[model samples]
Target: MESEYKHLQIGVRAAQAPKERRVLHRVWKYKLMYLLLLPACIWVFIFDYLPVYGISVAFMDYNFIKGMSGSEWAGLKYFQALFESDMFLTAFKNTLIINMYKMVSGFACPILLALALNEIRVKWFKKTLQTAVYLPRFVSWVVYGGIITLLLSPETGLINKAIEWFGGHPAYLLAEPGYFRFILVVTDAMKEMGWAAIIYIAAIAGLNPEVYEAAVVDGATRFQRILHVTLPGISGTIVVMFILRVGYIMSAGLDQIINLYNPMVLSVGDILDTYIYRVGIEQFNVSLAAAADAIKGIIGLAMVLITNQVAKRINDSGIF
Candidate 1:
């Protein structure tokens, strides 16, 4: 009986040994790919990892001349000061509200756009429309700024002129605190919707045509087909994208916000990124800014992890 047990153990060990061997061999097989990835990996290590050292300054009474070591430690004092500031509160409020709008509007806009494009029967017209929509995405927001300004300009913007032509008053869309954030959300969706649509389009395109053909044979209407077949096929993509967005909850679109924001609209438009620019660049509170950043990073990471875990539990398409 002892000999039989020993034999069974030897067989189990032999069975496990090849998995280890196979893993090592697979690693060796992809050695060149790993070599190719070295630059990007090193770049992340240097830029992303190395800069984390500066997070320490958030706890310090940092000064330029004193340098890192000589700077006095303040523990949680800066954070307490930040939490007490009205501007900080305003910044947090604006950031969350604006980003929530961006996330929902931006996320849904693309999927619907992609679905609409998929439904188009005419190839040439569809292609032209697709090109027109995507063209704005390639253009820099600097150029987009001029375009948007022309459209939203209080005096002569095409939209305002149309309003006047209809005997309505021109709304100074960007200037009003009530309208500014709404405009930001709408414009952000417009600018990036087509670009975001590209991924879903690709996902839809990769789907088996036979499934649609099968749906057609069963007399599934376009809406029904989309609801039943097309959507389920891309649910994983949707979940993954949703998870990814949840990961970046702290980032309000900095470029768009920076380009569009001005002194008149700071109350409605100031976000975490722009706040950092004000604190770090304008006021030279680099260490406090760094601390703010570290806090944002930690919160963002926590959100991602929580979101991913929840997604994994429900749908199993997770970033984990």
Candidate 2:
């Protein structure tokens, strides 16, 4: 029996030898690419994975000086507080409402823009239009928000000026709670739609030209071809993008909100991220802030899993 076991072990080792060699050879062949990837790997480890250890702070009464190891365990105290706090609840509600609108509009706008751009036959005109739309994405929210603020200014904004010229009263759009969510959705689309369309455009470009030609030969109109051919061809890309977007449901564009929102609109504009910032960083409620953030992360992960499953069930497609 011992002799047979030893032989089995040896046989397994022999079987693995060539596979191991092939892996090593492939790594050596792609050494340069791996070298380039090293920095990104390190950065992700340092900034992303490393912070995971701090999640423990949420379950403890975190102290700046005492730190995680020395802090007393508080269990679910902060999480309980999150639900009990009116401010946190309000923030959570606003987050959901704003994100829902943004999600729907954001998802559809890019596809529409990509389709529009794809239909342009004139190469120079198409390129110019693409470049013009894509330019806003390169600008930081700080700058873009400032531009939007100027445009919406009650007194001097271009928009208000146009409204005044049209015999309408100029109002402070940003400060109005009713108008705040609309502004966020519109601005988000304007800033991101073009950049987001690039992926869709690429996906559309990769579709079999022959399939499109067949559709044309079948006497399909331009719209009909797009509906039957272009959309189905890019469905996989759409599913992947949708899954990714769903995963980040808790994160509602912090930079844009921070730059654009004011005290007046906090009731309608404050999100989980801003709440965490205020509670954790501003108020120095470390444990409570950590709890909120941890919950946010957990919900985001759950969302990704749920959305992926739904996508798979609907059409046999998902990120996994």
Candidate 3:
């Protein structure tokens, strides 16, 4: 019994020592880095988190005059109203559908584009393609919206003119429910695909040339070398990006939808953000808007946690 107690005491001390050492070491080694990051950290705190306390408006009969603290507490009335309303349901569905489409197309297209771009041997051509593809990412949605609208207009638009040339009747592609989603997907894909590929391409570049050389020595073809060596090397980036994409499953492209959507196409194109904008800001119902924002925020957080947990279950690389 005395020996057992001694062993237990030693084990307890050993377990506690590492944690104590960790705290001390972090202070000693990473203190400078932490200090360097302090300004950016404070900026995030000021802008991102300081405003979160105002989320209480979601639970209250918010009045602009009363502000957050003075707002009348109405429990779950605002949230209940959101769930019960048909308009909310339609908006929620549209949000999820468009976001899911964005998630899949946005995710897959970039990976494929990155892989294809990585294969090009011509230095100048590859650089030009990369620049051209990624250039749209920097362009504002407002500018791209005008471009898309002008090009897709039913009357005398480039697409309609092409349709006429082919002896097919010109159609308002953006007006039709079926084609609106496709246009959104394609245009969004086009705008962001090159930019998205940047990270993957960077990852692919980091792979050791020796691996490729070894494969070639073993009589491996270029395709086989890429399939086995290049792909596995960059999969961690893929996994990380995929997890992030899943985390934002509730967020469709608001700017794209706002600029592109018309009343005729609202049934298919209207999303939660747009709905919230119309009901909260335009209609001046602050509490209801706050409630909608709260629900989306909670769901998005849940998605990130679930996705991170899944990634950790498969491998150690996860946001958590």
Sliding window of 10 residues with minimal summed lDDT for model 1: 13-22
How many clashes show up per model?
0, 0, 0
Q: Considering summed lDDT, which 10 consecutive residues are worst modelled in model 3?
A: 311-320
Put down candidate 1 lDDT per residue, 63-143, tens digits, no spaces: 999999999999998898889989988988898899898999999999999999999999999999999888878888788
Q: Which candidate number has the best lDDT?
A: 2
Model 3: pairs clashing at backbone N, Cα or C within 3 Å: none
Candidate 2 residue pairs in backbone clash: none
**Candidate ranking (TM-score, best to worst):** 2, 1, 3
**lDDT of model number 1:** 0.89
How does candidate 2 fare on TM-score?
0.92
Give the Cα lDDT of each candidate.
0.89, 0.94, 0.89
| Residue 284, candidate 1: alpha-carbon lDDT | 98
In model 3, state the lDDT of residue 72: 84
| Top-scoring candidate (TM-score) | 2
Question: Candidate 1's error at 38, in angstroms?
Answer: 2.6
User: Candidate 2 on 1-320: residue-level lDDT in tens?
Assistant: 99999999988986778887878878999999999999999999999999999899889988889888889999999899999999999988888888999999999999999999999999999999999999999999999999999999999999999999999999999999999999999999999999999999999999999998999999999999899999999999999999999988888889999999999999999999899999888999988988999988999999999999999999899989
